[model samples]
Target chain A: MNTTLQQFNVEKIRTDFPILQQEVHGKPLVYLDNAATSQTPTVVIEALQKYYREYNSNVHRGVHRLSHIATDAYEGAREKVRRFLNASSLQEIIFTKGTTDGINLLASSIGRGLIKPGDEIVISAMEHHSNIVPWQLMCEDRGARLRVIPINDDGEIIFEAYEDLLNERTKLVSIVHTSNSLGTVNPLRQIIDLAHNKNVPVLVDGAQAVPHTAVDLRALDCDFFVFSSHKVFGPTGVGVLYGKKEWLEKLPPYQGGGDMILNVTFAGTKFNELPYKFEAGTPNIADVIGLGVALDYVQQIGYDAISSWENELIQYALKRLQEIEGLRFIGNAKHRAGAISFVLENIHPHDIGTILDREGVAVRTGHHCTQPVMQCFKVPATTRASFAFYNTKEEIDLLIKALYKVIEMFS
Target chain B: MDELRDLYQEVILDHNKNPKNYFQMDEATHSAEGHNPLCGDQVEVFLKVDNERIIDISFQGHGCAISKAASSVMTTMLKGKTITEAKKLFEKYQHLITAEMSEAVDLHEYGHLAVFAGVREFPMRVKCASLSWHTMLQALEEKKEIATTE
Candidate 1:
């Protein structure tokens, strides 16, 4: 509808996603829930199909042909993830179920190795439940205290509060990269640097970041980073945890199972080296390969193009949504990405979500798994319409129209 | 759009906009909280009973329009009804809301409650509509735990 859409060639990108082509209810589907999980592109879907159709076997176990082929593709995905994050080595990349599984892995390994009684682990108020709960459980296990860094009214983490939270007793700092509820992109380099100064290892929940922005783990200097495959246009049940080699070696194995061992006996078991030591069982093979194809898919499109298009869409959405009477934005961070959450006066988010769905506009309406952030904003929930590269400016207009309909109905 | 209107009819909308008995009952004899954790909607049902009959019923909480309206109409229906009658009406209302859409809803039978008959089409909102009734049941039973319409 405007200049940015013309340059991005979103029509071409939309065609790559088959789900976006269909209609919901009676209208064209306007999928704006990219923060939950991006729609899988045809390339990723066909890659999944080809793997099962051709080379479907367990990885690094059998010496047969199909097994070898599957192993190569699986390991090749690790290499792709390693390069995608610009990690130092393939041994530093570990595959897990998703971001939740990755955090649970770290909580277990680090809880046993590093945390002691009376120690403190710091997380921000905007963290999703996945980031918050694991640390709480781990802290309970190790007799450590969970300290929360408060965010300002705009959903930006109070940097001073974060600084005050880190001290001699602070063992680890875990924080979100881009808030799923608030759309605020936290300053990671600054956050990580501040933690490192206090000898605290920082683990970043990059679940909302990697798809919308470039992440060079080496450049950011974060000790650990995690994101989901589905959020990055890959298959579900697959995710990557990028850890530094030195840290991965020090942390204990997360689980005990097949393929994560160099040698095992009834009397004793010697855990495998760096990454596989953490990856304990039959990993998600097809989806991992799908994740590689997804990485290739994004790299081909380029993050610059994706960010610019989504930026335009978000700006347009913010401007148009403001046109509706009694509409209020929940988060107004100076730096935001891909998502915009708002509330209509005297109308619940669920009602807005229902009306929007009737118009075939899919937006997430809830606390977005960040209840603390909701408390910070002093609302029960907000209607969130997150974007992807394939979303057009016209879709934002549809959302605006649906929102106006919500106002009419409620009035 | 017709389907949306079916779900949010004028009756429901009016009840939502000007909810009845929307207050905290400090002198209530029995009260229970209902929570829909998925959407963060909550309601507290309060009752004043005299000789097994509800003399007064009111509700206070935060939730969607369906929930607020449903709660308001529920309070109006339950006032001056016996405990047994309240339970019977709850069963009938629950059956109506959870009933199959293919079989037409008997609008005359439910009266005020029929406004919520459209909720069954939207499966996710059914819980929002049902939360108050369950919380009222918890209040009647004198249960300490919060009721959840998950």
Candidate 2:
């Protein structure tokens, strides 16, 4: 409904993603799996090609011309990430494999450093396994406790419950900014403020959020935030982890390797400063460069336009899906972004996924790596359709039509 | 579309909707839990084996149609068969679903399970179709360990 979204040309946007132009199973591809990974724009792909073709060399410690070009582009990507997240300095941005790697780095470095025995780590029930497992492992290792904040039936985290769990012993609160399985966008600003009140640092898993919403780290003031490049139309195998300067400075380096070491001897090794300390061996250079261009591409389109357009798609999807008899939406939170999960009576999500795939409507059907959320919903799994800015009303209609076919086949 | 229809044949749908021998067998001589972590599909196979013969078999769990139907067909077919005979049938069934067998091979040997031959086209669903049978094998072996179709 926004004027900017109204004027936005979706057909042109679709053209940017070459994969969307293809047909699957004799029907036009209807890609609705943005939460898993978004289709890459040609510009991002071109950036990757240019990097490999023009200047391919290992970053840092190399004095050669190609190395300088590669290192400049690589570090430039870090600066791009810093600017994208609105962080204060490049020291805050650490390159990672993806969200999983980022969280593991923090859990190993900070979790091992600060967390003492009997300390408590708080996380929400709707967290992806990446967010949940790393903290669980940390708690297990440190003899600390991992406490989960419960969610309502609507999939929103209960603020009152979260407050009750926050105490002096609560050392850190790691939660998802937006749930991957459930589309609920947590009240992060309030959540951060609440944790800050208890002097507990919070790490936000923003893998799902960065793709769909506008995230300003300074504005949110969360201690740590992580997201993957592939989810934002960039290359896979690369992501960003943004930590507060104070936290990054205090935590020990995660992996000890070439880039992270200042000096090494039989006695001990001096670790490099903030960002480099966390980044160990050679990072995904080409993908990191591609990620920078991906961020620029998203910025070019603007988040306001993206969010507005995706919201329209979600509303249209929800309304049309509601018309199907016996269809139950899994997460119906008041505030949602990117994805919608649901189940039809007496039908398995896998079967639905198969039938939909035959119709060329690509959707994810499984526990979505949130088994606890699936158990909370009392279903083995739910079929999920995640939207992007390029998805249109026509695609929603196709999805609805596919669902009808699923129901007919099952019945 | 033909592959889809074959995968979800009428027989599979009927068994999935109303799975035969789908109940808890408290007095079972052997039992094993099967799990597919990928999709959260769980199956518990309970067998009453007497003198190397499977006198009775039943299953209890929740999964997709392929898995549920496969479990139903497995329970029905394994009953009244000797342990050695059951193992042979299991091998043949596994081959039927997983391998590209010649058309000359009589699928009637697999009976109700021939419907699942379509699963050969869907490589991912093979695990779903075989979860219960794998658990059944574990139960027959009297293994206490949980069977995981990882």
Candidate 3:
């Protein structure tokens, strides 16, 4: 409510990035690859610099003053994440290497106890390899079967198929909140409710969602949510896994090294409680503090303003992209967000990516780590232009101008 | 623009649009499928060998202009050549693309392959330019494994 149109300044937001201020290849850089990773603002960068410059020490175990500082900063970041998702308690939040690692942590730890030989795990066709492979690996290990929910041509999930997939045998339903390759914003609440009716828990991949729009885990009521910090404008190699208290308590520990233990002897080892049970080894201390600052940055801007501005940018981008001859959009979901994928009639996506790069227009080319989506669409890959709140309509015009040069050269 | 033009020359563009020997050989003595996992671009190289000589060479796949044109040009240069000669040419081509352009690469030794010299400027795309070549090598060796431009 505080972020009115007057308070929400696009130029001020653009200044926060500073990476976009420079030239890439003889022209100003137009960075539109937010889905893959958002640019870190000065606040986040300074937070990281301060951590390493001021207090560089191991956390959780050290008895020294520096270690206490590091531990508090790291734990404080976890509280920020808990608040960011609006989860019930700090015990629900677990630090992970990234989204892929978070999913792997759940799949390996949960699959051991819950997934039986004949059980089935359901996932959508639009899931990234990160969300898909871990489940496949877990299912293989447990002799469980992996089931896929089909998608419509628009890259939206078919609710009927999803409903059909849920039954007594279904153990978990994992789906992406916003597809990275296609800008499809899935109906997470509907999905969670359907799974809950059958006593099946759901895991939401919010890597593409949390950055573009607001996400409240308490409201959605999903059992688990995973996302990468880098995708949310924080440092890379950091992510969070939020699980309800019951699920976190039920699942076993993920990895073991330093920390994550109450006691260790020659005979047995007693694991720690709550979030620490899953967090093994010395965590990414500096980056974790950086993530806290990043969350603060996002919360300060207010998602209300961020959402409206990004919606306008996406609409403008879609309209401008349509003006290009032979360009066909890959996804047409009614509730899309952040990213847009399309292919030039006879040109491969990578080729378009290459030409665009020369003009200082940065867009993601290739599969975007969603090969199944690529296979379903019957295209080798698509050139995806994903946006952040820092992006402007003027930047979109630059992208369109660069795209015309692509046509001129290739035509 | 000069660098972009260097990467996508007239010959490369023509070859991409109207590739020679661009088909699946039903009776290929040897064939190999290649994948650029990063881009999901796939290519298949088929070869008909008679007495250690490549009687005919062809390629069919889905890929970007650089990859497709590279395959097309490779097929054009490979047909009717002995396996040893093909291997020698591939070795030279690999060096040509990866070598520093600042050192003044001899275009005479490269010919059509010299167009890829621009790839040195764009290091990320070097794999795209060499995917088909690696697959062709795999085909010649009769390796059943799918080749990858890792």
Cα DockQ of the candidate 3 complex: 0.93
Top DockQ: which candidate number? 1
Steric clash pairs (candidate 1): none
Collision pairs in model 2: none
iRMSD (Å), candidate 3: 0.7
Q: Looking at model 3 chain B, which ten-residue stretch has the lowest summed lDDT? A: B111-120
Task: At residue B149, give the lDDT of candidate 3.
Answer: 97
What TM-score does structure 3 among the candidates reach? 0.98
Order the candidates by DockQ, highest first. Answer: 1, 3, 2
Residue-level lDDT of model 1, residues A315-396, one tens digit each, is: 8888898888788888899999978999889999999999999999999999999988888888999999999888888899
Per-residue lDDT over B44-127 for candidate 2, one digit per residue giving the tens place of the 0 to 100 score: 999999999999999999999999999999999999999999889889888888886445456777777788888877888999
Stretches > 4 Å off in candidate 3? A1-7
| Local error of candidate 1 at residue A218 (angstroms) | 0.8
Q: Which residue segments of model 2 deviate by more than 4 Å?
A: A1-6, B101-105
TM-score of chain B of each: 0.97, 0.94, 0.96
The sequence of per-residue lDDT tens digits that candidate 2 reaches over residues A1-411 is 656545788988999999999999999999999999999999999999999899999999789999999999999999889989999999999999999999999999877789899999999999999988998899999999999999999999999999999998999999998888999999988999999988899999999999888889999999999999999999999989999999888888888888998899999999888789998898899999999999999999989888888888899899999999999999989999999999999999999999999999999999999999998989999999999999999999999999999889988
Q: Alpha carbon lDDT of residue A7, candidate 1?
A: 71
Put down candidate 3 lDDT per residue, A1-411, tens digits, no spaces. Answer: 334446678888888886878998888999988888889999999999998889999998789999999999999999999999999999999999889999999999889878889999999999999999999999999999999999999999999999888889999999999999889999987999999999999999999998988888889999999999998899999999999999989988888866899999989999999899998888899998998899999999989989998888899999999988899999999999999999988888888898998888899998899888989999888999999989888899999998888888888
Report the C-alpha lDDT of model 1 over B19-116, residue by residue, as the tens digit.
Answer: 99999999999999999999999999999999999999999999999999999999999999999999999999998888888987778999789888
**How accurate locally is residue B83 in candidate 3, as Cα lDDT from 0 to 100?**
97
Worst 10 residues of 2 chain A by lDDT: A1-10
**Per-candidate alpha-carbon RMSD to the true structure:** 1.1, 1.4, 1.7
